[model samples]
Target: MNRGIPVRLPIGRGGGGISTIIIIAVLFIGARALGIDPMEILTGSPTTTTTSRTERTAANDEAMQFVSVVLAETEDVWNGVFQAAGVQYQEPRMVVFSGQVQSACGFASAASGPFYCPGDKQVYIDLDFFDELANRFGASGDFAQAYVIAHEVGHHVQNLTGVLPKFNQARQRMNQADANAMSVRVELQADCYAGVWANHTDQKGLLEAGDLDEALNAAFQIGDDTLQKRSQGYVVPESFNHGTSAQRKRWFLKGYQSGDEDSCDTFSGDI
Candidate 1:
């Protein structure tokens, strides 16, 4: 991502999740061990303060700038796509945070990975996840990181098109397995949309050699099956919320090759 005008938003703090009872218990135990009053720890009210910006390392700062640029590019591409259909594109705000953040959907930790909260029409991310993507997932490179942002933005596209709510409603009436299947479709579609954005970027000569490979490797690395196998030592096909690595790679390539949104449809057909 070459330097582009960055969209800087206020970094919010004090998201509400993380087991309050467990946290208090730990604090109480620690206070007792230190000969301090547990009441002081328990009675201290949490103060609400804004974190306008988070401290960033040189690498993190560079990644943030790159993500900002990629986001701008996605906006340009999707805005054009929406305009072509005579529908207005509402650009989503990106909230960059460290550790944990509150979202309209709920509180989330960095381990939750990047996500789009349709409730607020915002994309939340922690740049440090890029390090995890590389070090743990073994998917590295600028385009790989850009794909993560684009995929979340893709969910925003789904929200604007009313796909997300419809799917959520369908999921509510479904069994766990069926709902997970629907979720896989939703996720794969986002992956496809990311590729659609990549198609546009490539047309503008923004892609370098190995960029597509990086994005594809990323899609493979994060596939539900791959993640599950590594964590659980077994694969449960019915529990997969995202497609398999092969499926992810195929769908992404389909979108990249066709460059047609219609071709990217994962519903009303066998996936």
Candidate 2:
């Protein structure tokens, strides 16, 4: 997710001749729609919330175990990839919170969605989001959840590879449109990395029939275009920090078919 403004503009696909103030206003509204404080996005001030851990019921326990197993699988895959490349992979910690959580990046609610914070080399997720993923987004299946975790882990890989740091620094100098375009590449690459993981998992005979469909559906459901259309009835391509549904699915399929990290590069000629 684009942590800067976290906006979902309702305007048309391109922001031609749109004023800065208008853009800011739309961003504020978008943040509000996501249950985030607009002021927090503007002022970079953290929200203070007394977050209690969700009581673990039988179902919650099962979900936790499932998440742990998926994470472990990612670790094994990335470790082997890094080892073969003569680099050490630093595993990231996962924090599964309830309503809210504090992280090195900043205070984030469940509304912020799952994110990998390069600041502290950690991934934060709210299990409730998985329910939302299934019921709200219509992307149901355990493999969809696994795809989410793997995508965040892919961000960790970007951090380790210096891709994220370079993007973060370079974005400071870019206009909103340019930055959003760049962010789409970043997010798509992460999706591709998740596909690479899926390929490895399949090789181990862990993926069942329909598993790839589950992941692809998840990617399509969460694409910027799809989400924008569902939420606001329109898509603002200029504000699409994540790729469109087609782009996301295509890149992921590319990675899965190739099963090579080199094929996951989205910084080249045309994404």
Candidate 3:
């Protein structure tokens, strides 16, 4: 492999849905995991909602194994990182859903994107989003997909440490711009966390040639600037909630390079 970044990823092994009567998994901040009866998240309104037809194409099947391997890697890295900090790492469930899924947060379409629902302490992802990565986001490659999952897992780490709840609470009274700015920090830090995971797997000798660049490309591909530029004809700094391409790439690279959690302080980093 070149002494610089690589793009091809090493092999890795690696959801949803329901309507009104769906019983889904849920997570409590300081308590054990809970199950969400779709009825609860929807309030007293008894409504049965149908999912987007659970279709397990070859893509969805392959995406599952891929994410599982990535999650295992994250478990290894974060366990060590949290251990080093004298805390125990709590392993979070990374659920792969096709089409639509119900969570404590509510029903989410694949277009709603991958997200970590703090209430459930689980990472939700629609495997078809992988194609969205390649076709729509221009972020093709398994490593890139792994990066996306790792980023969501990072939020679980943040939630365990109280960072997420703090942000959610803090954002309640803030203006949209300021809230988005805060979101950018959270997302960037998540990117950094993904980087940290990469560094760990690398140290463990899992990365192959072109893998890092695949991740970097994927990372760069999903930035607010790139997405916005693709969707809208322009990039708006004020509307950026996930940082620019440069910032996302920078934070992920920072974590990958340092392999240290201290370097992921996006809250203080300049955009």
Best-matching candidate per lDDT: 2
lDDT of 3 by residue, 39-112 (tens): 33222212112234646566544444445545655666787789899999888765566667777766776667
**RMSD of each candidate relative to the true structure:** 15.3, 13.8, 11.7
The C-alpha lDDT values of all candidates are 0.70, 0.73, 0.66
TM-score of each model, in listed order: 0.80, 0.81, 0.79
In model 2, the runs with Cα more than 4 Å from the true position are 1-52
**Cα miss at 76, model 2 (Å)?**
0.3
Which one wins on TM-score?
Answer: 2
Per-residue alpha-carbon lDDT of model 1 for 171-251, expressed as tens digits? 778999998898888888988998899898788766767778888888888887888888888899999888898888888
Query: Of 2 and 3, which scores higher on lDDT?
Result: 2
Candidate 2 global TM-score? 0.81
Query: For candidate 2, lDDT tens digit of each residue in 1-271?
Result: 3342221111111111222233244434544554555444222223211125866677655555555556666777898899999999987767767887777777878778887788877777677888877777888777787788888889889988988888888999999999999999999999899999989878866666777887888888888889989999999999989899999899888889988999998999898
Error of 2 at 69 (Å): 0.6
